[model samples]
Target: MRPADHDELNRLCKGVKKSFVHLETRDSYGTEVELPHMATWRRGEPDDFAWLGWWLEMLRGHRAAGRTCRRARVVSEPVSDYQRWTMSHVGLFTDAGEDIRYVARPRLATVPLPGSGDFYVFDDELVLFLHYTGNGTNLSFEITEDDRTVRTCREAFESVWALAAPLHAYRSE
Candidate 1:
């Protein structure tokens, strides 16, 4: 079946019991929602962070309800302008209750990772793989209830997660 839209990808997170984990491997992200602000950031100009944005608000609510939400981004060294921009907001994400970490791609030479796309594993049951267009545009996603997919992704994510530096220690970005 076709995966859900990005907006619908997180319903499982809310339904999760233990944790909702995200793995991001892209150097950049493209979405109409944040394009303007991202452009302003690249220009080195002040931009609105829109703390009340839906994503952050949702995270806050999840946290308030005692659910743990976390994300790990595998990025390249000397981070791209987009990654750098995202790094600047690490605090915002964490403050909203996400435990964001950064993993250097080069360091994962021997590590097995999710191929092609990123995935979010909810309570170790649902696995949603996110796909993107060549231009970094958000495209689509595929979710699987397959035990093998979920188990393998959770293992890969955990392995990378173990080596990832907490946002505060991840100064390269």
Candidate 2:
């Protein structure tokens, strides 16, 4: 694929800004913690420090918010290794609100798409993909009408939710 022109890239970024920012990451913990920071950055004017400060402030603000927030939920297939680690980190910064719902399933048939990391997004919803590839993650996104991808993600989550078991229901502490 040919490299995108600078101006074209800028225009594309602007379009993304109008839509929602999509962030797919292997660092699940960092990305989750970075949400509020990203929100702060977006609310600030475009200065060199704007982005940096936004993330830093978001991290700080999230800690201050409480150990749980009324607005967050943990939906996953309950991978014994990764998801647990990711959610623990998420819990630490979720204090401002106290309504975190942990949704988990024992297994969901993996969806293979010839990639790594699956997908991670911070648009209208924060999406994390579980089955993608070997090591790294894949962060592919396509902008469709009125956030069709967001709906697609929500649907995917719901499907998994239907098949998943509650964490406490299945496993003993």
Candidate 3:
């Protein structure tokens, strides 16, 4: 099922009961809400990061409710400018109770991933695939509850997560 809008996606994510695991394979994302901040970063300007309040609050709520949220990012070594910038601010997410990790692309050569894009598995039962354009603009969200697909994505996320390092300890070497 395709989420009708961003709000629908947020509702689905908010409804996750036990766990929310995400696998992000993109080097950069051109999200409208983030682009301006990224530009400011590129210019060496300071940002208050107030825009992340909503997301951090949600993570806090999930944590308070005993729900676990994890994210594993597969990135190329010598990360892109976007990834570098993102990593710099990852503390906000971590501090808010999200477990975010990173794995170099080379480390996944021997691993089998379910698909070629990004996805989120909620409660290990629903899979939300994120479709993006070549330039890293999000296109749509497709959700599925098919057991096989969910299992494959969950396993793939775990495989990558196992090889990942916490963002604070990650080095691009």
Candidate 4:
């Protein structure tokens, strides 16, 4: 299925029975939707979280359904402006029940990652591979449920999650 639209993610969240895990392996996301906030954060704005209510609400609804929503990000140290900006918003999602964390690039020096970049695993079964161009526009998505694909992504996420530091700790250091 083409998960190009936002509703598809909502549907997937609704269908998730056990858990939903998202692995984001990028230092910067050049998607236009996030550029404005990234720029704001780069300029040292005190309100980097003015735009995350909707996402938090969605996560709250997902958690209300008795499902777990977790996200782990893989990033290089001295994180990019975009990543720092993104992290500022992680608090919102976490408050709404998504377990969020970050794994420094060096920590996974010998470990391998699944797929090319980011992906969302729903119920640890349906894997939605998020494909992005060099510019990070989130251009395409490939969804699959093949046992190997699901298992690989699931394992990859678990490993990263284990090594990742929670948002508060990462920001404090």
| Candidate No. with top lDDT | 3
Predicted candidate 1 versus true structure: per-residue lDDT over 56-167, tens digit per residue: 8878888988888988899987788888888877788788888999989998899998785588999888888888897788778888889998999999988988989987
For each candidate in turn, the TM-score is 0.90, 0.35, 0.95, 0.87
The Cα local distance difference test for each model comes to 0.82, 0.36, 0.89, 0.80
Cα lDDT tens digits, model 2, 79-157, are 4334554343443333322222343322434522213223323334433333423442322333223355556654554
Q: What is the Å distance of residue 8 in model 4 from its true position?
A: 2.4
Model 1 residue runs over 4 Å out of place are none
CA RMSD of all predictions: 2.0, 11.0, 1.4, 2.3
Alpha-carbon lDDT of model 1: 0.82
Question: What ranges in model 2 sit over 4 Å off?
Answer: 1-80, 96-133, 138-142, 146-149, 161-173
For model 2, what is the error of residue 98's alpha carbon versus the real structure, in angstroms, after optimal superposition?
A: 9.0
> What TM-score number comes out for model 1?
0.90
Q: What is the lDDT of residue 116 in candidate 1?
A: 53
Q: RMSD, model 2, all Cα superposed? A: 11.0
**Candidate 4, residue 34: how far the Cα is off, in Å:** 1.3
Candidate 3: worst 10 consecutive residues by lDDT? Answer: 1-10
Tens digits of per-residue lDDT for model 3, 1-173: 54545786788778888989999999999999999999999999999999989899999999999999999999996899999999989999999999999999999999999765799898988888888899999988888899999999998999999999997677734
Prediction 4 global C-alpha lDDT: 0.80
**Any runs in candidate 3 off by more than 4 Å, and if so which?**
1-4
Better of 2 and 4 by TM-score: 4
Candidate 4 wrong stretches, greater than 4 Å: 1-6, 45-51, 171-173
